[model samples]
Structure formats: structure tokens, C-alpha cells
Target chain A: MGKTYALTGNPNSGKTTIFNELTGATQYVGNWSGVTVEKKEGTIKNSDIQVVDLPGIYSMSSNSLDEVIALNYITKDKPDGIINVVSASNLQRNLYLTLQLLEMKVPVTLILNMMDEVKRRKINIDHLKLAQILSLRIIPTGADDRKELKNIKDTLTLDEVSNFNRFSYFSEDVQKAINELAQKLRETEHRLENDIHWLALKILEHDREIIERIKIINLGAVELGYKLRDEIQKQTKMELPEILAKQRYDYLREISEQVIEDLDKSLVTETVTDKIDKVLTHRILAIPLFLTIMLMVYYVTITGLGDKTIAFMEWLVGDVITKTVIAGLNTVGASEMVVSLVVDGIIGGVGAVVVFVPQIMILFFFIAILEDSGYMARIAFVMDKIFKKFGLSGKSVIPMLVGSGCSVPGIMATRTLENERDRKLTIILTPFISCGAKLPVYLLFAAAFFPSNSHIIVFSLYLLGILVAILSGVILSKLRYRGEDSDFILELPPYRIPRLKNVAIRMWDKAKDFLSKAGTVIFAASVILWFAQSFDFSFSRVVEPSDSMLASFGKLIAPVFSPLGFGDWITSVAFITGFAAKEIVISTLSVLHGVSEGALVTSLQNIYSPLSAYSFMAFILLASPCFAAISVMKRELNSWRETGFAVLYQTSVAYLISMLIYQVGSLII
Target chain B: MTIVDLKPGQSGQILELNLSTKIKNKLLELGLTPGASVMFVRTAPLGDPINIKVRGFNLGIRREIAQGITLK
Candidate 1:
């Protein structure tokens, strides 16, 4: 088998940057089969060995999903060696994770990244001295600098051996206990000496997985661990794990003192970050700043540049593609039925969804910038206080923000939250946030019927989502388990100039995901919709049907929405199609109404009045997210029950809100 | 005194924890053991969940929990 190596580190450690540089064009990025967690694997440019870039995590303790994924891969997959990437500037805390990995006895080569950052901060690290003390080869590298790849590649050739011995910073009594356990492991008949010792230490640390594994190997190991724990507690008067952790930190501090030199005490970047945070995280300024930024983003994407791009694409599809296809069908002497199905159903339906790609890309562009520049983290920090009042953490803000991009990623991002209750609540409420996919539907209706006040209408729809999400969270917290008290702990990565390459890559990745879905799920749905609309159950001849199946279904459900003002069968069917993907709603409308050549604005006005249009926007904003989002929620929450609850809750909220809007508006108008 | 009483930039060593049993357990899980040195990072304008640097990471603790953590 070819040798495998893994890149593991804490968040914001430039681990991904290093991987991208090493693998270059060889990398493949996709989801981890059924899970929403991203899986990245690639081979070294000039080597046969494959490298897997695990998710960024603080430690291998499995407190969070990233940790679980990282730890599971390292321990179970048993890579030939592991590259323990550490940020040289943040050596003290980074070393904590390194020490944990060392205890696992994996053949680890330390890659000290961000050497340039350390130099800029006036910190000097004696790499040779550090390597000697840790008993591992260390390579100091600046991930952004291509020159450091050669040094990293050279160190990768080192023998897969761990020479380090475990050191405990605990009291002498606890150390004696560990030493005894270590001696027992050495004396065992097991051929794997390193694995045995590592397993024993993990047992001492109360690692559930290790304990379970030991039970399967030898029940006697459990008795030995119990005795060790009892003896250590009796002698040290402290918890076994805490004692070990303290001891490790003590040793780390000593090593840090010797090998690290700090020439400057002031962290200039931190000062700047804090100054920015003061305004960004300020209670009064925060919401307004957030609103203003979002407004600018929406204006640029939905009404400004993005709208223009989308309009052009729509024109190309509706005017050019549809006309060409129709002309071809006519020249071939094709039946009118086949021509309408080909031109109106397939082309029009798919065209509606594809036209919204520009808006989605522009929205993701701003989101990527916000996330990469570390402003998204601050948004969480500032919003945490408000979310806390509703029994949620600051981290919950990420899901909500992501929901604005697409509920699928928003629901997936909930994995970062540690609290199960918080995760569930966040997932369920995420659909309330107006996703980018829903923008076309909103813009379509808003621009047509509520032209002059379209901006305000769109803004209100987004605001309504926030209100509903918060209200649902509050209600759920009060009703559900009251035991989980939410708390927030987040690392504030020092703000740097957003790298254009990284931003572009992120934007491209997100846009690619949208396009891939459009090509597959939306494309298939469009074709199927075309087939359904073309054929009908008639007498004997099987001639062209008067009304398609979709039209019939729309008529069936249209009455239920009559209270909401736009009870038109075509409009109802459009809403139903949105369940597949929000952009498909517009496509369905265009196909159903036979408006083969018109802007979404013009097409929407033919179907909805001003009051009904506003109500439709409200409904789409709060409706159950696309099928992909529901599936993601199922995966992240790991419970069909929770996913079902999310869909049910969203649909109910959408119904109630839309009803209220339609009723109130009709009475006033 | 509890962390809630500490001004911004004030540093202190944790002396005692007076939180409810459940909250205490949660705090312990997050590596906030007694005797850890902490520095006040900042407070929100409304003064809830005061930010503090502890155990080499930033943590935001609510006023209720902050009231429980006595600092020396």
C-alpha cells in the first residue's frame, strides 16, 4: 500500500493553505460520502504518497465534530505518519495539541508554520532546540512562501519513528502510577510496544474509545487502569487527567521558555483587531453595521450587478436558446406538443434556475470574504449576547449567517456547535433566514409588483426570517430540555488582509457547488417537469393534453393559498417546485405560464398582484429549505426526527406568516 | 471577587467556583479548573457574558456564571 500522511492542526493555523500548496492541481474536494463534513485528499506533486487534509481542530478529544473526524482518521486509519502542523507564533497553546498527539505515539513530524508571522511579531523560535527537546524533527515553514515546500518535502523523507518519551506534569505520585502502567504495557506479550503504551495513557486519561478498545483486547487492562486511577487519586489528591494535563503544560512551558524568545510584548495586530472589534462587536454599532453590510451585499448582488448579469443570462436562455430550439423543432416538422415540451417545459424550467447562478455567486463572494477575513467570527461574538438570552451560543450565529447563503451549508455548519440542543435549534431555525437560492423568487415578485419599494420588501423578508428564527429559538428553549446552559468560547484569529486567492477559491468552490446541483438535481427535475407537463391522461388517442399534471396539482393546492391573495394554480405549483430548489420555483412559474421570453419581473407580474407578491416573498423566505438542506440537517443532527421537525416547523411558520401578510394587506389595500 | 466584578484589563487567579452543579460541570469540561489564571478581555455593552482569557483561550461567561467564579 502507498504511504499515507495527514495534516492536522487547530483552526486558522494555515493547514489548508499548506495542503493546497503541496498538492497543487492533484487535490480532490468533496463531502465525506454521507456526511456534510468536507473531505480533502490529494497526492504530493512529485511523490506517490497521498496526503489527507483533516478538518482543523483544537485537540483530538472529539468534543466537536472536527475533533471527532480528525481523531477518528488518525487513530483508525493509522496513516504511515502524521504531520502535526503548528503555528510557530502560537507555540504555547499549539504545543498542547502536539503533546496530546505525541502521547498517542504516532510517528509525528512537526511542521512549524507561519514563521514569517513569528518574525513580524519579533518572536524567535530555536527550531533545533525545540526539535531536540520534543524528540521529533521540526521544519519551520511559511505556508504562503513557496520556497518552504522544499524544506517540508525534505523532512517528509525522515524515518517513521517516534523517539519521544511521555512526560507527566502531575504530582510525583501520579507520575509513579503512569510509570507503572507504562512498565506493565512494556512487559505485555503484545508486539506493538508503542501502541500499547499509548493505549494505556489514553485509558488513564479516561478516553472512552480507548477504554472500550482495551475491553475488547483484554478485560484485565480495565482492572489495571482502575487500580492505577485509584492509586493516583489516593496519592495525589487530584484528578488523574487534570494532573497529567497540568504536567504536560508545565513541561511545555519549560521547553517554550528555552526555545522561544519574545522581543516585543505588544501585539500590534491584536491591537488593531481589538480596535476593529470594538466597533464591530459593539452592541449599538454591531446590528447597524451588520445591516449596512448585508444591504450593500444584497444591493450589489440582487438589485445591482448581480441582477444585471442574471437578467442577461435569462435573456439568453429565454430569447435565444428557447427560440433556437423551437425553430429547430419547427424545421423538423415536429408536433406542437413536442415543441412546447422542448421549448417551454425543459428549456424554460431549467433556464429559470440557471439564471439565478450569478446572484448566488455574488452572495457567496461576500460571505467568503466575511468568513476568511475573520469578520464572521466577530459577528458571532457580537450576536452571542442576544442569542444567549434565548439559550444559544455565539457560535449559533454562523449557521444563521450561512443560512443567508444557503440553508444546506447553514445546517451543515451547525456541527461546529457543541451543544446538542443548540445544534438542533439552530438547524430548525436556519431555513427562516432568506437563503440566496430564495433570492430569485423574492426578487422576481418584488421587482414586478412592488417595483418602487422592492428594496424595502426584500429587506423586510430577510428581517422577518431573523425575527422568526429568534422567536422559534426562544420558544423552543423554553419548551424543550432546560438543562443545557449555553456558553461561548471561540478563538479570535488575528485579522489579516483577506487574501484574494483564498477568497476567489472559496467563491469558486461555493459557486461550483451551486452549479453542480443546478446541473444534476435541478436539471433532472426540470426534465421530469417537462415530461409531466407535456403528457396527459386523455380518452383513446393519447393526443396533447389540455392541462399538464403540474397544472392539475396546482389547481388542487391553489385553494389552500387563496387566503394569501395569489391563489393562482400556476403560482401554487411554482411554490411546490421550490421544495426541490428555491430557484426552480421561478422556472416552474415561467414554464406553467408559457412566458418563454421575459424577465422574471415581467413574468411574475403576469402571475401575481402587489399584495400577493409581497406575501409570496414572505412565504418563500420562511418556507422549508430545499431537499438538500433537509438531508444535510438529517446528517448533521444525526436524527430523522430532528430533520422532520425542522421541515414541519418551517412549513408551519411560512404558512402562518404568509397568511397574516395576505390577510393584513388585503384588508388595508 | 467574581469575574463579573473585574474591570477590563484586570488579571486574577481563580480561587473558587460558586456555580450550580450543572454549570460547574460544563465549565470544568471547558478546561476552566480552579486555580487557572485569567485576564479580563472585555465586556459587552450590557455587561453579560464578560470575555476573559483563561487556559490560553478566550471564554465568554454569563453574569450568573461569572458571579460564581471567585477570583483572587
Candidate 2:
């Protein structure tokens, strides 16, 4: 039987590129159990070892679902041998989790990844010495280079190697506690081998899960823990865990001093990153830089390159693809019902989602650049103060920025936030940002209604989203959880020139997600929608009857939206279908209004006045997110009550905003 | 001086923590007991969670928590 090892690290730690090199074409990527976050697993080429790529996490402290999931899997499943991946350049911070894992007594092999980056920064490490001190097998692998990876694969047989010299600096009190805990363990029937001292120390520090485990073995362990903690405190006059941690850090510092040789010339890169930070992370300049970047992204994805691609795709689908299918159906003498189902239902519905793939790709392309270049972290860092005032962490800025591309990932990104209240608030407010999927819908309306000022209108819509998100966050914070604010601590990695290969792969991955949805869910949805629209449930002879099944159902709900100025059956149906996915709003409109290729703008103009169009855009912008987003919120928030509240709040806000826009705009016009 | 008074890049050993009950509990949970040597990392430009080295890891604590922490 082949053994499996997993490579895990924080985001931007070069994990993916390493995986790509190791596995190449032998990889299979799928979603983690019951979640949309991608799970990557692959067999190591020519080797018996299989590697699973878990999602990136900053810590395994159970602060977020990602952390919880990562920690639980490692502890419960217990991989054959865990590969602890860390950034070579950021060893000081990375060693924190490494120490935590060592304390867990997992057989860990440390891979100091991104050695090239460390070399570029002119930092030298004595790998053998450091490995001996850390009591683990250390491999310095440069992910960007494939030759180093091959070497790692060839040398994977070394196991049971323990370097005892790792503990260089243990406080006297901690050493005493460890001794006591080890003695207590020896008294039990079960052999407490393999770092029992470390486990006992963790228990004394009140690691919740460890405490629970110890309770199951012996309730008296808790008493022992209390005694040891008190003794340590009395002797050292310090908290047990803190004293232990300080000892570890001091050991790490001492080890780093002997192992790492920092060259003075490395100051150049630091200066460059700092100089860029002056403008990009500047208190006053940051917002403008962010806004400019966002605008460029939107412009490129919507009206610029993305719009051109979408236009071509629209023509291909509406003209060549659909028409060809119709012609083939006609020649085959296919039944009208079958023809309608295949052509109008399946083709139209799925085509709606398909058309937006280009835009999604472009949007993710920009996102990849921002993320890879390390600019996204700065965006979060700069926005932390502003978001904190609204009771959100700096981490909230990630979801908000991603929200502009797609609310699903944006909401999913909220898992980075440690506080439950703040996470929920960030999730609730994320939809206010105009996602890329909603861009076509916005373009359709703005071009129809506010043609000359479409740029300004588009810009204002985004601004409006930010304003609404902030206002809601503030109001909710005041009304709900008001206390000492949660602090935001983020590692600001030095900016580097983004790798084009990595950026392109990330963009392709995101675009692939959009295309896959179009083929599966959106295609099926369009077919179902077409069937509902074309066939009457009760055999009606007249196809255009007012009492037809689709018409009656649409009419039943149309009046609810009357005050918002788009109460027609077609508009109501578009809104309903939009709940499946935001991009469906445009496609539903295209189908219902009988607009073929190059006629979406004109058809939109015919269906709605400028005032109504603007109002409709506002409603969609504020409405309940798609099912995927809701599911993610449920998973991340871990409560249907919170998810239900989010839906209700978003829907209510959308209705009010749309009504206000329509009523006031109509009065003015 | 308190940790709040320490400049970036300064190093100190924790002497005392005078946090509010809630914050104190949170800190205790995070294992920030006194006598832990803390090295000041960079602060956020707006200065909320002054980055500090603890337990061989970098931790960001709010100014309110920093105010409570006495350092040498």
C-alpha cells in the first residue's frame, strides 16, 4: 500500500507551483467534502507517496472553519508522515506553527519552500545545523525550480530520525511541569511515549481539544494540570504557556543566529518594497490607488477586453450555435416540444452563463495579479483602520475586494476573520459590492438608461455598494455586538514581481470554475426554465393564452415588484432566475424579451425606461445572493439562523433601495 | 514602560498585564502570560494590533491590550 503525505502552507507561500512541479499531470482536483473550496490531490510521479494539498491556513487554532478543518484532519486522520511546509524567507513567523505541530508529536518533515526567494533576499541558512536544532528533517526546496523537487522525491525514505538537540532554551518551570506530566503519564496503563512532555505542557496551557482528550483518559489529569500550572506560575512568576512560548522563541532566535547569515546588500530589495509601500500602503494615497486599480479592473473586465470577448461569445451562441441546433432539429423533423426544450430552454439558459465566462476570466486575471504581487495584502492592511471602525477586521477587505469579482469567493474569503460576529457582518455586507457576474446586468441597464453617464453610473454603483456595506456594518455593530474591538494582525509580505505563469494558472482556474458551472448547473437551469415558459402544465391549445401556466405564475408575483417599476412578467421571471446565479439575470432577459444576437441593449431599452433600468440594477445589486454564496455563508457562519438573517436583510435592503430609486427618479423625470 | 510605549523593533520582557476582564481572558487564552519576552514587530500604519513576537510566533494585539501589558 502506498503512503500519502500532504503539503500545506499559508497563501502565497508557493504551494501550488510546488505541487504543479511534483505531480504534473498526475493530479486530480475536486472540492473538499461539502464545500466549494478546491481540494487538490495527486500521486507523486514514479513514487509510492501520494500528496494531498489542503487549503492554506495561518494557524490551526480553530479560529475559523478552515483552521478547524485543517487541524481536525491532521489530528484525527493522522497522515503517515506530515510534511510541514514553510517559507524559508519568513522562518521566524513560520516556526510558530512548526513548534505547535512538534508539540502535537506528529512525525513532521520540514520543507523550507521558496529558497530562491531567500537567496534573492541574500539570506543564508545552515540547513543541517538548523534541522538538528529543530529536531526534524529539513529540505530546502526552491519551488520555482524543478530539479530541486526531483531531488526531494528521490530522498524520501529517511524516517524515524529524531534530532534531540532541538530544545536549546527551556525555562526551568516548564521543564519541571514537563517532568511532572511525564511521571503522571507513566503511572497510567497506556504507554505515554512520543513527546508526552510537550503534550502535557499543551494541556496545562489549556488547549481545548487536548484538555478534552486528557479528560477521557483520566479526569485526575485535569487536577495534575492545575497543580503543574500553579507550580510553574509560582516558580517562574509567569504564565505557563507564555513562559514555554518565550523559551521556544528564544531557542529559535539562538538557532537562527547560528544558522542564518544576513548579507548587508539585501537592504536594496527591502528599500524597494518599502518605497512601493509608501504609495500603495500610504494612509492618504492607498484609497486612491485602490480605487484606481478597481476601476481599471472593472473597465478591463466589463467594457474593455471582457466586453469584446463576451460580444464574440454572444454572437457565437445566439447566431452560430443556437441557429445550427435549430436547423439540425428542423432537418431531423424533431417534435416541437423536443426542439423547444433543446433549443430555447437548454441553449438559451446555458448560453446566458456561458456568455459571461470571458468577463469572469478577465476579472480573475486581475485578481490573480493583485494577489501574486502581494498588493492585495496591502489593500487589506490599509483598509483595516476604516473597516475596524465598522467593527470588521483588516481581513474583511479581502472579501470586499473579491466581492467585486464574485460574491461567492468574496463571502468564502470571510473565513479568514477570527471573530464570528465580524465574519457574519462581512458576509452580510459583501453582496453590496457589484460582482463581475452582475457587471453585464449593470452594463445592460446603464447603457439603456444612463448612456452618456454610464461610466459615472457604474463608478457610483460600486461606491454605493461600499457606502451601504460600511453603513450596515456600523449600524449592526452599534445594535448588536459592541465591546472591545477585535485586533487585526496580518503579515505584510515584501512585494515582488508576480510570476506570469502562476498568475495565468490562477486566472485559468477561476475561469474554468465559471465555464464548468455554465456547462452543468446553468445549462440545466436554462432548460428547466425554457420548459416552464414553453409548455403549459394543463394542456392548453392556445400557446399565448393569458391563463397559460407560466404566465399565471409570473403574473401572481409581478405585482410585488410594481412599486420598483419593473413589475412585468418578464422582469419578474428574470429576477427569479437570477437567484440561481447573478449572470442569469442578463440571459433570462435576453430569452424573455426575444432578443437575439446584438440585440440585448435594444431589448433592455424597450422593456425599461432609464429610471426603471437604474432601479432594476440597484435591486439586483442588493438582492439575495445565489445559492452557492448562501451555502458558503451557512458553512462559514455555521448557522442557518445567520444565513436566513442575511438573506432577509439583503432582500429587504434591495426592495427599499429599488423602490426609492424608481419612485424618486420617476418624480424627477 | 507598557508595551504601548515601546517603539517598533524594540524588545522587552513582559512584567504585568492590566487588561479589562474580557481582554484579559482572551489574552490568557492566547497564552500571553507575564514574563514572556516580547519583541515589537511593525505596527499597522494606523496602529491597532502592534505586531509582537510571542511563543516563537508573531501575534497582533490591539492597542487596548498593549496598554495593559507592562514591559521592560
lDDT of each: 0.74, 0.72
Interface RMSD, every prediction, one decimal place: 4.1, 5.8
Residue runs of model 1 more than 4 Å from their true location after superposition: A31-36, A168-172, A179-194, A263-271, A282-287, A319-339, A538-546, A597-603, B15-36, B54-61, B64-70
Clashing residue pairs for model 2:
none
Residue A214, model 1, lDDT: 63
Give the per-residue lDDT digits (tens) of candidate 2, residues A1-669. Answer: 777776777655677777776776677776766555656888788887888887776544544577666765676556666677787766655666677666666667777887877777667877888787777887788746656567665555564435453333676666667778767765663644335665576677766665776676766767798888987788777666556656665565555667777422332233445567667756566778887987788787778897689879889988899889999999999998788677666776678677778778788888877877888877777677778888888778888888888887888788767676777788889988888878777776777778798888887788878888888898888886576465665556657677777677667777777888788777767766665666577665335524456667888899999999999888888888888888787767766654553577786777688888888888888889887788877877778998899899889988998999999888888
Strongest candidate by DockQ: 1
* Two-chain DockQ for model 1: 0.34
| Number of residue pairs clashing in candidate 1, backbone atoms closer than 3 angstroms, sequence gap of 3 or more or interchain | 1
Separate clash counts for every candidate: 1, 0
**Local error of candidate 1 at A65, Å?**
2.3
Model 1 lDDT tens row, A130-199: 9998889887787356575666656776745767766555566665666677666665537432476667
DockQ of candidate 2 relative to the true structure: 0.26
Residue B52, candidate 2: alpha-carbon lDDT: 63
Question: How do the predictions measure up, each by TM-score?
Answer: 0.91, 0.90
